[model samples]
Each structure stands twice: as C-alpha cells, then as structure tokens.
Target: MSRTRRTLIWGALAIVAVVPIAAAAYSPFLAWRSPVYIVAGFAGIIGMVLLLVQPLLAGGYLPGLSAYHSHYIHRWVGAALVTAIIGHVAGLWVTSPPDMVDALLFVSPTPFSAWGVIAMWALFAAAFLALLRRRLHLRFRTWRLGHTTLTSVTVLGSVVHAMLIEGTMENMTKTALCVLVLSASIKTLADLRVWVIRTRRFD
Candidate 1:
C-alpha cells in the first residue's frame, strides 16, 4: 500500500475504533450508573471494539505491521480481548449477582443477555483452542478451521448482543462499528479460501 493510503486506513480505523468509546465516556446516561457498572460497560465496549482489530491483524491487513509483528500483536490482542471480557462479566456479576445468574443460566428476561453469554463462551472457547492447539496435536488446517468457526460464532453473537441492548452506547456509532466489523471479518474469510489449504503431515 502507498504511504498516503496506509495513513488513511489507520486514521479510519482509529475513528471507528475510538469514537464509540469516546461517545460512551461522555454519555449522560452514565451519570446515574454505579462505578462498577460504568467500568463493566466500558470493558464490554472495549472487548467488542477489539473484535474489529482481531481479524485485521489475523489477515495481515493492518498497515505497517510485518507478518511476525502482526501475529505477535494478534496474540496480545487476543489476551486483551479475553481480559476485557472477563472484567466486563466479573464487574457486572459483582454489581448485580442476580442478573448475572439469570444471564448465565439463560433465563434473563432481556434477550441480549443470552446473546452476550453465547458470545462470551464462544470467545473463551476460541481463545482456549488457540492456546492449546499445539499441545492438542491439532494440524494447522484443523486449528484454523476450529478457531475460525468459534470466532465467527463469537462475532455473530456479540454483534447481536450489542445491537439488542438499549444501553449507553450511541446507536449510530454502534451500528457503524458492527457493520465495519462484519464487513472486515467476511472479507478476510472470503479472501482466505481456507478449504484450499492443504494439510501436510508435519503441519
């Protein structure tokens, strides 16, 4: 990519990634919320935003990152994604154990709760697979397939979860972020053509 185009891409990424969080920080709705609730909500927002970054890094689409550095950052981003989610859930649970229980048990009256739970588990599962694929003797292709499937689930569940919530995040920015995340994920997956990847014995 040309230097100018790279700069534009990075700028666009920053806008989409940062705007919603910035908007949330200034939302009037947060004035009445508890500190734990505010922290939990922002953690979830950060986690969802990281979803947009994850696929770009995995597909090496992020500008200026070498393959090694991209993969390295991808791993660290995965760790951050997990931590943000854990903080999101743990904070919420602390703030309201009953709601968290209902959500975890799939009995929450709010439909978004189920989707959030589903996404959380899907993300955790994908992360676990990524961490243990080598120890599990998974081939390269097999690992990719499993990880990609779980990740797709995570993205789908998360987008739905986020969209369904009538919460602090601004609707316009949330929708834009969701569209970008889905478009980027679909583009990367379509480009990979993973079915054509041949699995060798050593791989």
Candidate 2:
C-alpha cells in the first residue's frame, strides 16, 4: 500500500476508535448532573478510552511510530491510565463516600463497582510489578508473563465495569469501545506468543 493510503487508513481507524469516547464526553444528559458527577463520569470515559489506546500502543499500530517510540508512549499512557483511574475513583468518592467505600470493600450492591475495583487494583499491581522488575531481577519472560496476566485482568475487568455502568455513555458507543479494547488486547497478547516461543530457545 502507498504511504498516503496507509496514513489515511490509520487516521480513519484512530477516529473510529475515539469517536465513541468523544460522544460520551459530550453526553447531553450531563446538563442535569452536578459538576462532581460530570467530572467522575468523564474521567471514567477517558480511562475507558485509554484502555483502548493501551493495547494499540503495545501492538505498535499507530502510523509513523517506531516500536521503541510506541513502547515509550505505552509507558506514558500507562501512567496516564493510572492517573485517570485515580481521578475517576476519587471523583466518585467525592460524590459519594459511602458508595466508594462499599465499592472498595467489595460490598457495593452495584455489580460494576466490583469490576472497577478489580481493574483498579490490577492496574496498580501491574505498575508495581514494572517498578520492581529490575530490582527483583526477574527474567524477561517471567516479567512479561506476569505483566500480561495483570493487564489481561485489568482490560477485561475495566471493560465489564464500564459496560455495566449505564451512566453518561451511549450504549452502542460504549459497547463498540469495549469490543475495540478487547480486540486490541487480544491481538497484542497473541503477538506476545512470539516472545514465549523465543523463551524456549533460552530454556
């Protein structure tokens, strides 16, 4: 394919990936909601959108970026993802402390709460693992395995959590984002199989 064509295709894909999120952020229903809830809701939406980007970065799907640059962006995006999650949870807590506490304790009546909590912790665990990787002297394969496992949980749990919430996000758009997130994650994980195969050479 010509470079121009590839660029256009990737650009189109990027727009398709983000349009749902943009629509959710502008949700007309937000007019009736308080600022805190609006912040919280948008934070969650941004985090969900980030989830879709995360795997795409890892898979190096963005046009014109080298794998090294893509991975660098991936790391930064991971940090942003953590920040977004904190903003989301903290905003929700501000809106309702008791509910947030219940969610944290896994006793929230809302099913989405449990999944969000799970994904949150999984994200933290993944970050911690990355931090400790060099200090712990973990093998490359071992680190990859653990990181991938935690990421899988984070992605799946976050998708479920977001889908369950019937808040500001439009249903069809939210579902489409979830599908894209899952597809990107699965594709990246499948690519990781190459790493697994290489590990056998060392073993």
Candidate 3:
C-alpha cells in the first residue's frame, strides 16, 4: 500500500478501537443515574486519549505523516479535548449540585474532585498562554519553560483525578488507559527537555 493509504488505514483502525471502548465506558443509560453524566464521563476518557495523541501527532511519531499534518491534527484534537472536558464538568454539575460546589471550593469530599479542578485550571492557563505566546513577546525558551510547567501540572492532576474517581474509569481498562495517558505525557515532557538541551547547546 502507499504510505498515505497505510497511514489512513492505521488511523481508522485506531478510531475503531476507541469507539467501542468509549461506548462501553459511557453506556447510553444507567438504571439509576442520568445519561448526561455517563456521556460526559466517557467524553472525558476520550479527551484524555486525544490529549495523549496530540503530542505524538505533533511530534510526527505517527507513521507516514509530515510535520505540518501532525500540527494540524494536534490543534484540532486539542480543541476536541477541551470541549469534552467542558461537557464532563457540566454533566457532573447537573448530576451532583453539592459536589460541584465542593469541587469549586476545592474542599470536595471526594479526593479526586480537587485534582480535577486543578487540572481544569491548568488547562485553561495553558490554553490562554498558547494564544498569547507571540503577542507576549515570549522568548522561545521562556515560553517553553512555562508551557512545560503548566502541562506537567495538568497531566499530574488529571491522572490523580482519574485514579480517584470511581465512576466511569473504575476498572482494569480504565487503569490501563490512565497508564497510557501518563506514559504519553511523560514521553512528551522528556522529549521537550531533550529538545531544549540540544537547542541550548547549539546556540
């Protein structure tokens, strides 16, 4: 097969694998609970997976792709991730009013709530900074430093939140998903560090 055809095939296969897992995680309806929550939880899981892939795609780790293609995919996937997280939070708010208040106050009875909140804020900050990166006259080095710091916090908080939550991601499948997400995040961070070091040495 041609390289482009092979890439498309693999990407399709990945999407296929992801769909059923998402469906299973977020069933259409639960006997005693609202479907919105389920949908949001599943969206959250999918968002994390997309976030994991964004760095890889942007780094051209995906087979038969150019850097520009990777960059485009990364940007769109990031937007999707943000949308999914918003849906997840909104659903949780609708389903559990008191819990939402506690989460906002960072005093939720659930250990994971605080982490989730923190991650949300970090994500916001990172997004905002990305938008302002050029306007802020940020040196590439400084911008990278700040971005890495915030991204690390976001990933850590997200992992903690996922692990502590007993809702959608409660079993071995979720556990594996979490590990994959963490590994991906770690790999990206390591790569970034290496890049920075090499650039500094060359300069």
Q: TM-score of every model?
A: 0.95, 0.91, 0.83
Model 2 agreement with the true structure over 96-181: per-residue lDDT tens digits: 99999999999999999999999999999998887788898988788878988999999999999988988799898889889988
Off by over 4 Å in 3: 1-23, 26-29, 194-203
Clashing pairs in 1: none
How well is each residue in 1-203 modelled by candidate 1, as lDDT tens digits? 89999999999998888999998888889999999999999999999899999989978898899878888998899999999999999999999999999999999999999999999999999999989988999878888889899999999999999999988899999999988889888987987765567443222
Candidate 3 has its poorest 10 consecutive residues by lDDT at 194-203
Model 2 TM-score is: 0.91
Clashes of 2: 0
Best by TM-score: 1
| CA displacement after TM-score superposition, residue 28 of candidate 1 (Å) | 2.1
- Please give the CA lDDT of all the candidate structures: 0.91, 0.85, 0.73
Candidate 2 segments whose C-alpha is farther than 4 A from its true place:
194-203
Task: Provide the global lDDT of candidate 1 against the true structure.
Answer: 0.91
Once model 1 is optimally superposed onto the true structure by TM-score, how far is the C-alpha of residue 144 displaced, in angstroms? Answer: 0.8
